[model samples]
Target: YRTAAASASLPTFLLVGPSGSGKTAFATLTERTSIAQTHTSTQPLTIEALLPSPHVPASSHYRSPGDPAYERSRRFLLLDTPGHGKLRHYATASLSDPKSIRGIIFVVDAAALAEEPGLNEAASYLHDVLLSLQKRYTSATSSKGPTGIPVLVAANKMDLFTALPANLVKHQLEKAITEVRTSRAKALRDAGAALSGGEDEVDEEREWLGEGGEGHFEFSQMQEIGTSVSVVGANVLGGKETGSVDGWWEWIGENL
Candidate 1:
C-alpha cells in the first residue's frame, strides 16, 4: 500500500482530445518510446512516464543527471482519458478535482480542424475544458488562488498534406471557441427568459469562459485565470520511422 500511495502522489498530466486525435498513440509512445497500433479507447488509462534524456525537468536542472533526486524529478503520470463523447466524463472528473495534476495536454488532429464538423466538435470540447479551469480559478477560497494549470494544444498528424499549420490551428480553434461561447451565452439567456428568474443571472456569469464582452475569444484571455495555453505542432506518426514529439517532451519537462 505504501508503494501505491507513492505512485498516486506523482504529478499527473491529463491527456484529452477528440476521438482519433492520437491521445492513445502519444501515451503509448511516452511509455515505450515507440508507436504501437492503437484502437479507440473507451476508458481512461494511466501510465507512468519518465521525461526522456537531453531534456531536463525544470525542477531539477541544477541537479546532476546521475543524482537520484534528479531521476525522481523526471517521473510523472500521464492520465490518458477517452476522447469519445460518451466517455468524456472520465476527463471531466479529473478536471473537477485536479489536485495532483500538473498540466493538461489536449491533443488535436491537425487535418481534421480543416473541416467544419471536426472543427466544431474539437472546439466545443475544448471550450468546456477551458471553462472548467476558469471556474476552478474563480471559485477558489484562498486569497492567492489555486495553482495554475497550463494547457498544451498538441497539434498532431502534421505529416498529412491536408493538415493545417500550427498558427492556423490556433486561429481556427480560437474563432470556433468564440462562436461556442456566444452560442452558450445566448442559450443561457434564452433559458433564463423562459424561466423568468433573477437567480439565472449568477449562473450565466459563472458559465462564461474568460473575460466577459463582445470581443472574440483568444487563448491569451486564459492568462488572467493563471492558465497558459500553447499550440505546438508535431506528428505522432507517419513523419518518419519514429514520429517526432520532442517539442511535446520539452513542454512536459518545463512543467515538470
Candidate 2:
C-alpha cells in the first residue's frame, strides 16, 4: 500500500465513464496490457490536464498498441474523461492541478448494477460520483490531512454480463466499508479528530478509492470452501476468492 516515503504528486488519473465502460481502453487496454512493467525506450508517459467533456462516452486514446515508440517507465497518467450524463447540459471537472487530481475512477457498468440498484443509471452515476467524492476530498483534505488526495470507485464492466457476483461484490463492499468506517469514526469522535479507519485497525488503509490496492477489503460468506479474497475485479465472471475468477489475475486489488 505504498508506505509513502515520497513521490506521490504524480497521480493525475481521471477516467469517467458511460459508453463502453472501458474508458477508451484505459490506456492501451489496462495501462499497456495489464498495467505496464516492460521497459523499452522513447518515452510515452506524460499525461497532464486531461479535459474530457462532450457527453461522456468513449473518447478514445490508448497509445502504443504495438507501434508508436515505447518505454513507459512505470508510468500512469491516463485520462479519458467525458460521458457524464451525455453532455450538452450539466457538467463539471475543470479545476487545474489540485496536486494532480489525486483520484477518481468511477467506471461502473456491471450490467447496470444487476438491472436496478437505485433505479440504475449506474446507480445515478454512482451517487453522483460518491457525492462528488465526499465533496471533493472533503474540500481537498480540509487543510491537508487526507494525505495527498484519493478516490476510486471502479465498478467497470464486470466481465460484461450477469452483473455482480464476487459474493455479491463482497456484500456490497462490506457495506461500504462498514459505512465508511463508522462515518469516519463519528466524524473524528465528534470533532476531537484522530483517525483513518478511525482509532485503530493498524493498517492505515492503503486503497479504497484510488484503487490499485494495498490492504483492506472485508465481507465474507462462502466460508466452507477454502482460498478467499474478494470485493471484485479479477476478471471476475463469478470469483469468490480467486477460485476461478478468470483472467487479468484478478484486477481488483486497488492500490495493492
Candidate 3:
C-alpha cells in the first residue's frame, strides 16, 4: 500500500547547489521552454515538466510516441530548493526522506568553479549531499538494498569566457571533493575527541564520501553504493549564440 503510493507519485528531480549557480534559471527554462529573468529563490518551488520533443524517456523507447503511457512517462516533477547557505535545510531535509525522488541535479556555475572560494563551497555542499546518499544506501535493512538515486552535476553558465569545460569541471570537482572529505573526517575526529575527553573511534566509514583510502576521490566510487554521478554542460541564458540545455534535457530523459 505505502510502496504502491510511492511508486505512483511523479518521478521527481531535486535541483540543488550553491547560490548564483543558475539553479532557478535552469528550473525556469525547463518549465517554460525559454529562459526567464529569475531572482535568487528564498523558498523551494515545485514545477511539473514534460520531456521536450526529440528526447525519448528511456522507459518509453519501445513504445510509440502517441501512446498515453509513453507520454505519461515523460512527465515528472522538478523540485527546486533554495541554494543559499542558510536556506539549504530544505534540500537536506528532502534528501533525508526522498520518497519520490528519482534523481538529483546539482547545478554549478562553470565560471565560478574556476575560483578557489566558489570551488570549495560547491565541493563542500556536494560532499555532504553524497554522504547523505551514502548513509541511506549503507543503512538500508532491505535485503535488496536501497534503490539508487543517480546524480547529475549540471555544469551551468557555459556562455561565460571563464567557464571551465565539462571535463575539467568534473576533474576539478573530484579533486576538491577529496579535500572536503579529508577535512570533514578530521573535523569529526577532533569533535569526537573533545566530547569524549580522549581519542575515540567515530565509525568514520559511514561518514566518508567515497572508498576509504588516501586515493583521489572519483565520482565513479559512488557506483559501489548504487548511485551514479554524471557531469553535463549547458547554458540556460546568455543570448542566442550561447544559450542551450539540450544535453541536460536529454540526460533527464534518459533517467525518466
Candidates arranged by TM-score, highest first: 1, 3, 2
lDDT of 1 by residue, 1-256 (tens): 3397788888999999999999999999877755699999998999989999999999998999999899889989999999999999999999999888999999999999999799999999999999999999999999999999999999999988899999999999999999999999888988887788644553777899888777889999999999999999999888664357888999999999
Q: Per-candidate TM vs. native? A: 0.95, 0.27, 0.94
Tens-place lDDT digits, model 2, residues 11-103: 456655454444444444443424433222122233332222221112123333333222221233555555546550222442233345544
lDDT of 3: 0.91
lDDT of prediction 1: 0.93
Q: Candidate 2: where are CA atoms >4 Å away?
A: 1-26, 30-103, 106-132, 137-152, 156-167, 190-256
lDDT of 3 by residue, 1-256 (tens): 2354543588999999999999888778766755588988999998778889999999999999999899889888899999999999999999999868999999999999999899999999999999999999999999999999999999999999999999999999999999999888899999989898899568888988889888799999999989999999888888658757888888899899
> In model 3, where do residues sit more than 4 Å from their true spots?
1-8
Residue 77, candidate 3: alpha-carbon lDDT: 82
Q: What C-alpha lDDT, on a 0 to 100 scale, does residue 43 get in candidate 1? A: 89
Q: What is the C-alpha RMSD of each candidate to the true structure, in Å?
A: 1.9, 17.0, 3.1
What lDDT is obtained when candidate 2 is compared to the true structure? 0.39
